[model samples]
Target: MEVTYLCPHCIGAINALDNIILSAKTEKNKHGLILLHEEIWNYSVIQTSSINAELGEIVDFFCPVCHASLNTEKGDHYAGYIRMDASGQESKIVISREYGDRRTFKITGEDIESYGESARKYMYPEWFL
Candidate 1:
């Protein structure tokens, strides 16, 4: 039977439970909540975008399960750098993707720092202006 769950983000009702017959021969269900969290993260990624990285490549983002905002420390092989400005919180990462003729991306540490400050200033104009 498919069980229903109330999604925390959408605030909507959804099915969550699944029927599974466990054999008595099995010792234990070794996995627990952490595994569940990992699954949740994967689910979020699938639900959010159609674009995806290639095999062996991962575009790491915030931990969707924990809802703790994440910052990218370094870019990937495809993109040089990425920066995010959300709710006055600044985050940055260097990423790469195959976009038309552009194959690689890179950003300097100084540029990242400058971008962070610029984001902060944009959010609070009185402080910088």
Candidate 2:
């Protein structure tokens, strides 16, 4: 299956991959201070990177096109929507989380019954049903 990461604010495509999105972190020096750096990797190329104020700090994702934050006032974690297309099926998936761990998923599309079901089966939150 193919997955596409988008800017929920501007509905701009961030990265499209044949596989799932991957993330990694490393410490880097910035402005003479060492900071925790995290990056989103797409096909082994760094797509986006950010420096955190401290370790385990939750950084917000921004739209590359409009520079709008992907998270809302609800929490410090990611709470954005993503567009997925597979086998001629197109759908928008809403990803929401309170913080730390809990997350909610909502799917909408012309064929939500089948596309959403497929997403629930392949992705996390099997309770999406």
List TM-scores for all candidates, in order. Answer: 0.18, 0.42
Candidate 2 lDDT, 8-110, residue by residue in tens: 5666666533322323222333211111111111112222334333444344444556766555554334345465555544344433322122233434533
Model 2 has an lDDT value of: 0.38
- Measured with C-alpha atoms, the lDDT of residue 100 in candidate 2 is 24
Q: Model 1: how far is 53 from its true place, Å? A: 6.4
Q: How big is the RMSD of model 1?
A: 17.3
| Model 1, residue 57: C-alpha shift (Å) | 7.1
Candidate 1 TM-score to native: 0.18
Candidate 2: clashing residue pairs, number:
0
In candidate 1, stretches whose alpha carbon ends up further than 4 angstroms from where it belongs are 1-44, 47-54, 57-76, 80-87, 96-129
Q: What value does the lDDT take at residue 91 in candidate 2? A: 49
Give the runs in model 2 whose Cα sits over 4 Å from its true position: 16-55, 88-129
Best of the candidates, TM-score: 2
Give candidate 2's error at residue 121 in angstroms: 20
